[model samples]
Target chain A: MIGRFLAGLKEDKRIWGQRVAGQGVVVPPVGYSETDGSAGGDWVEVKPTGVVTAVARVHRPIPHLHPCAEPFAFVLVKLDGADTALAHVVRDHLEQLRIGSRVEAVWAPDAERHGSIRDIACFRVIS
Target chain B: MSTSGPPKEPVKYVEKQLHLPYCYVAGDYKVRYLAALKDKTILGSKCSRTGKVFVPPIVASPESFAPCDELIPVADRGVVTTFCIVNIPVIGRSIELPYVAASVALDGADISIYALIQECAPADVRMGMRVEAVWKPDGERQGSHEDIIHFRPTGEPDAPLASFMHRL
Candidate 1:
């Protein structure tokens, strides 16, 4: 589930500091739930740098079932400025997966994006 | 039906395929069940209270709602409880046309598992027809239901309807 970052709402406004601090509850990276504007202000886009808060490896080769046909980990990443963890796949460096390992997103090309979470191909471990 | 002079297409149209990957964790019972498939052994979960056995081990007994952890090895041979012939081809279908997708109830099993009944004519697939698992090469086994490539006829007599009637 891609977060609908409301930070674009008047980026030049004076409340940028307060809006940047807005936190949203991402029930589970895949479940969609935008900031209700009650707990915090409109949730805005934050840097993708974060840590893998939870992880699990998939071992099935179901073609259309899940993305990773080869063995890969499904990690929950807690972005630096975000309040909740977002779920995404981590491949290549499976050994780097842990509760607090730093990571970043590797986005898909512009021609491949259909405005969905697939835009972000997969997460890569940095630390 | 459109009563208008002519049908017109919508102004905006777009096609998209949902290609998100999902990693699912098969729970305790499913883990052990699939693990047994690696060795080509069929395991059943027996409900201590009612004594009913399920081929795909259940977390708990359905009849008496008891904790069913005891794993019992069952026969690989069984009878087809029901089946549908694949006359039409579909995308992503690995199997060829005129195949039988039959639900086979293994011996001493209360529930049946769905699988393809092949190596014979689809027209020959009858309800209660005896069948057995055609496991993949031991080297290719990957701890999944796919380990059993497909089921084929055993050339045995069809089981009586009274035997699998309760299952259907």
Candidate 2:
């Protein structure tokens, strides 16, 4: 049930998280979320699009190889409908980075996806 | 310490394999270091207060607790302050067996860099051995430590032990 919104990521779909109230479907629902274990928020349909809140151009190495292996952008994006932000890598649009730049998720290839946070390969600028 | 309860039923469990690969933002200071790596240069940060340098520069000094913004270009040459020789094989390691992971304190820099040491026998690697970064061709370079594939012995005499004594 918690993955319903994120599983949508596999199909390039997005959803707003929602919590139960007298009469409301919060754009970014306020409650406990099971997706990330710490969300402490409820899940709901949200817009796939978002705006970059914070960004970083990454170029470093660890013991293991990473997908965004070379220099790239690691960013935190606030969704159009949700209040909280999701952290993901951003690539192919280093020149246009600015606060509130529009962006969207790029899903992993079918073979590489296993329906977790990594279902999205990285976030990409909307141009 | 065995539990005093009756044996519980073994619940069936499925094998789970998660392959979530991701990136790490080395941040502003390390990014500066990476940019220099592509040009076959090494960089470290110098504290405005204590004058201590940090390899793979950071936001602040360890001792003085002041913001460190000075970008100092460290030399490609340095001594192997310490090292390890891996003899057993690992399934997914890139380098061959019997390689060295060394701590190198570049000339002119106060801090040392932890990187791979190659092109020499495992037994030959030792503390105070002079070595240099072996860079990839200019065209093949990416802003990464990998640009310098590994360090190799410079064939020069080892430096005096006092130079790198604090590193260990």
Candidate 3:
């Protein structure tokens, strides 16, 4: 049901001119141009390795049920070459997460077509 | 967690129009008076020479200011100058049904007031139709647009469209 909701909001067409840093490559991602009148930006791809800049514990469960058990950690990950950090739920326990913890993006088996930040699964600890 | 009882009945719902209170402030003098409407009572300023009255009065007369202080009581009942049908539903409206909103020119006032048209059908409404204020009961007046319930057609003969043509 959640997947369907996300899929309904997804735009299949790519919006040119806006660039997003993905997997360490600065690629032309789906977004509008802030300067150029035309669509499409210089696309580049990057590695997915990132550092955990901040981490917070979630004591309460979200409205929807997750496949995992209760008491997970959420982390703000600063991917390389990206201006802003992406927020993703951390599956590790509260005691395990710390500043500077290296993590990597774990893609869903079938990339969830949700038009949301959760298209990618939780970032797992690299070590 | 699974519930032991049988499934509960789903709630039935429908969308309704929400009427929001709006102050129709027009003209320079009325703008100043409307600013004070929230606090004090202010009538239009009248020209002493022309004997013409301006509600929420203007500083200078459109023709010439005679420096008049003569303020007259304007009957709330006025004729509709112009109006449009609001068939599209707006989000967060307080009035439940689709209603006609109009610009009414109250008696003894030089200016027209924009307000909601009520108690009439969209087809029944026409320009220059006579309308009156459906005021809230005594002690319920808030001195705002909401104070007057939506104006209902007075069933009086429609005024000549030419009389209000210039104002439109």
Top DockQ: which candidate number?
3
Interface RMSD of each: 18.9, 17.4, 19.1
- The local lDDT score (0 to 100) that residue A25 gets in candidate 2 is 36
Tens digits of per-residue lDDT for model 1 on B1-168? 111211122112234667787899798778888999999998999998888898888869867989887999998889999999888888888778878998999999998889889889999889989999999997999998889989999999999999999877
Q: What would the TM-scores of all predictions be?
A: 0.53, 0.52, 0.46
- Per-residue error at A80 for model 1, in Å? 34
Native contacts kept, each candidate: 0.02, 0.00, 0.00
- lDDT ranking, best first: 2, 1, 3
What docking grade applies to model 3? incorrect
Q: After superposition, how far is residue B30 of candidate 3 from its true place, in Å?
A: 11
> lDDT of each prediction vs. the true structure?
0.71, 0.72, 0.59
Task: Using TM-score as the measure, name the better of candidate 2 and candidate 3.
Answer: 2
lDDT of 1 by residue, A1-127 (tens): 1122211111211001113123443422222334443333333345667888898887775677677679888889887665677778887788767889999877666566443455567889999
Chain B TM for prediction 3: 0.63
Docking class of 2: incorrect
lDDT of 2 by residue, A1-127 (tens): 3344444444433444554443233433334443443433344455667899999787773334445666778788877765667777787868887778999877778876554567677877985
* All-Cα superposition RMSD per candidate: 13.0, 14.5, 12.1
lDDT of 3 by residue, A40-122 (tens): 33332334557888887777765345425677777887765544466777775456678788887665545453354343557
lDDT at A111 for candidate 3?
45
Indicate whether candidate 2 or candidate 3 has the larger lDDT.
Answer: 2
Chain A: TM-score in each model: 0.70, 0.70, 0.58
